[model samples]
Target: MIMRRPAVAGQFYPGNENDLRELIKKLAPEHTPSKIPALGVVAPHAGYIYSGRVAAEVYASIEEAPTFVILGPNHYMYGSAVALSTQEWMTPLGNVQVDEDFIDCLPIGIIDKDELAHRSEHSIEVQIPFLQYFFKDFKIVPIALGLQDYDTIKELAGELVKAIEKYDERVVIIASSDFTHYEDVDVAHRKDRALIKTIEQLDVPAFYDELYRINASTCGYGPIGAMMMACRERGAKYGKLLRYATSGDVTGDRQVVGYAGIAVY
Candidate 1:
């Protein structure tokens, strides 16, 4: 079955190729990464007007890649984990092939097949145009994470590492997420900074703990948890919070959604 592109394209991002290219060109970093990372990245998935610059920070860090394993929150559907639509995902840019081999290797009990789960999911879809712009040609294993607990995230992450270990292709792990939704501007910055601090310390557990305690409305908590586990397993030593801001900063609104760009190396 064909997986469709479902997002507010022109509204959220530029629909025209030339316009989109120009936007990406304007946002892309002037300096390229000297060495490519294999481990983890956390990027926002809000509209381009709100999160494009922050998202660019993470995407720009990756010089090139043949494959990426993307973990994103299940926004439109609720479940444990949905390995939905192993078909190519369509975007205005082009089709990004799903890594069927890697999907096949996932532990059977952990993955569920459900296309409806992905139909209106913008979390994963929003990242595609950015990936297409930067990488040009690459395949992705798209995994939609649900409301699973932290321990479950760790277990799944371990399985993910083992599943793709034998592949010769260079793979990047991208966790698509937006931080702290619909708080006042001041509140958003304060909460996002606290979370960023935790990420910088590589304290994933502490990050979750603090988020729960403070009720930081980060939607990608599950994906972040999984990414932290995967990064640890891959021996990632450092994390850098590249950019952090809110929709308020972009739109000059009091009510805002937070966006962050992070790199784990």
Candidate 2:
């Protein structure tokens, strides 16, 4: 059995299980509002110190499911344009099962099973611990996208919707992304807020247009688009912005990377 080991342990998050758990306990709110049955969520992928709270807010607000479909950007473009990993993923928390049965439902043509694409990607890897913290028994389907055009995202979303329908367990789609890379805090907020508003509307075209208009350096627009389209197809009403912050908020730096946590239900 191939095991996809943690690539960013100790870097993005703590490598020690105890420390990781402690940190998550602290970052996650003490009082979680009544959780909702969300179809999908958009969470950020960055160092835990920077984006962990945003991720925690999204996770805490949503109800747990038997399976999670995590879509993240291919930062290195290491493998296939659209890559899916069939191997179980390992984090400091433990080995999380990969939903191979669910993966079998997806066609090989569009989303190839390529471990290389996920080998060193932190986007999906960072989200696993949060899942482990909230749910005890669950499986994940991790897909890394190197090609994130609107058409590709839409096609992938359609395939995901079909797969979820055929599967027996409840599932939630997570789009792992971080917005406005390394910019002045004011600029980051302005650009990210515009994109966040567009995301709340579930308007893909306007999101893309706003992204282009500002030339935002968001890392996972494709993943966000896929989640929005898939959730809309599944009858979700809209997205709610639970939290928004940037690295600057943590470190008091002028330049920062924006993070937003949103839930679609």
Candidate 3:
């Protein structure tokens, strides 16, 4: 049997199905678009209470079936390129089957499996409940990206584009990330906005340079980099900064983590 992992079910999201359902309903956009989005979305993955509204913006932009390729950073473990879990992902709602077929089609060395790496990782799990709420009958391709060079990421993105090209599947690609962790609220806002501006311009190299210069602590930088490559290859024309805020806004703390919602099209 393919194991179904439930890493952060109770901590990041509600553990109860009814409660989780209600929370998603409340957080989802009031008016979701009827048209499908060609490009993917980049969303923050913090505690739901802190980042749910921002995430809702990304979900609202997705108006199609439930198949998604969720790319997230490896917060718990580190290894080679991207890690693909063979296990199914479990949440309060149910188990979401991993799209092993798609995983197998990716180029060799592009994907690997490390059960321990995903056992407690919160980034990918935090996005599941929201996905379950919006998409009913869908499959997932969960990738935990580790340290990788730009060329490696670009290669993987290119292969993914080719692998999924022929199918007319309603697929939504999501990059799970949070911006600038543990800085003063005001400072985080300014820094994250600058980063967001670079992202809007579709300038990944500039975004990378600026982020490093400022010592921005974006945990999911690798995944974001890979997503940018994939988006560019898939003809993503523009990016929208849907929402931006810090954890301080939610908890009234002087020090906070930055969160931003971005959509690419």
Superposed Cα RMSD, model 2: 0.9
What is candidate 3's lDDT per residue for 83-142, written digit by digit as tens? 777788888998898776676666666667766667667888888788777767888888
Off by over 4 Å in 1: 32-38, 78-80
Q: In model 2, what is the error at residue 51, expressed in angstroms? A: 0.8
The weakest ten consecutive residues by lDDT in model 3 span 163-172
lDDT score for residue 244 of model 2: 93
Name the lDDT of candidate 1.
Answer: 0.79
Report the Cα lDDT for candidate 3.
0.78
Stretches off by above 4 angstroms in model 3 are 32-38, 78-81, 166-168
Q: RMSD for each model, in Å, please? A: 1.9, 0.9, 1.9
lDDT of each: 0.79, 0.93, 0.78
Q: What's the C-alpha lDDT at position 169 in model 1?
A: 70
Best by TM-score: 2
Pick by lDDT: 1 or 2, better one = 2
TM-score of 3: 0.92
